[model samples]
Target: MKLFLVRGTAKGTLVPRSALCEPRAPHFLHEPPARVEFLNGTGAVVPCVVHGSPPPRVTWTTRAGQPLHEVPGLRHMRPDGSLVLPPFRAEDFKEDVHSAVYRCLGTNSLGTIGSHDVRVRAGERLGTLSV
Candidate 1:
């Protein structure tokens, strides 16, 4: 009787060949951000978590389809998949253009997934009353 053995292509490696396979599509851990609010001159953060076999890359974009990083000092994407919005200035409140919707996108070798629309509202600060 003859015996057959299955060996991995690489030598001296304990990792199974299947472990190097491509990852599955990304999925959300929970419902993506639907809306977020912030006061003028205050920073804002929106969290977007995702799960996948090999991990996915996270990115942010505005509702108008503009990349978040291209917004100069206003927007930044954190390593933990959170979008950061720097404090707004008085000039930003004049046109109301700063209050816009955003979306988080996760992509891997398998496919891409987009989070729900997140409306960011930067409300004006109320004045204090003094006697």
Candidate 2:
């Protein structure tokens, strides 16, 4: 990814000074799976590994462009680019989070890239009974 360096552009838009190599757009190192399933009240993690010349900032969002953090019970973990889905009771299930397709975006000075869609859902949990 070459920097156009247009006039009046912010200096921060250029490649990081610490980076020695040429600027490169973000690419996925490890993409999230097609689907992630967890039991009710059990949490799950969706990992998205992205690498670039100057390191990109990863953000999670739904396929519909809704930010992952905007969804209740979902957390965007920093420094690792992983989405954390917090545990919640069956009655507290949110369709927006449980039945949504998520995608991770890696953005940097060079460019931005998006990961494949990943569907997240929580199955009903059954309790054991002793006679």
Candidate 3:
């Protein structure tokens, strides 16, 4: 089993176990897209990326704690270390679109890491209204 030490919480911080530290489990980080553009009538396209060490797994999920694959209209693609969305349905888009919470999860044989939530929106261009 892999060993992990979580930090940065309200519970305060803990000292690093330098005596028992090991470098077997490579560090992992996610490179999720900072922004996503939702065009008119086409669908939403979200790109999830991963950074840091290799051999990682990436997936998405909803704020309701529902698995992404279980959610409709959400398509996931695994290519290299990027998650591609061919297209999303209008109906499904309604669920995760506009102020909805979508999370990108990355995992490796050693541990798992997730990126900041990517908010989906329905608009044309930044600061432009869709009519």
> Could you say which candidate leads in lDDT?
2
- Off by more than 4 A, model 3: 1-30, 42-44, 51-54, 70-74, 80-93, 97-99, 123-131
lDDT of 3 at 38: 64
Model 3, CA-based lDDT? 0.54
Give the CA lDDT, 0 to 100, for residue 12 in model 1: 41
Candidate 1 stretches with Cα past 4 Å from truth are 1-22, 93-97, 126-131
By lDDT, is 1 or 3 better?
Answer: 1
Q: Which ten residues in a row have the lowest lDDT in candidate 2?
A: 122-131
Q: Rank the candidates by TM-score, best first.
A: 2, 1, 3
> Which predicted model would earn the best TM-score?
2
Model 1, position 109, has a per-residue lDDT of 82
Q: Which pairs in model 2 have colliding backbones?
A: none
lDDT by residue for model 1 over 46-86, one digit each (tens)? Answer: 88987786798888777876777645566777898988777
Residue-wise C-alpha lDDT for candidate 2, range 1-131, written one tens digit per residue: 44443344566455443354668899999988988888766778888999997899999887888776645455446569988877777787777777678889999999999988888877665342111
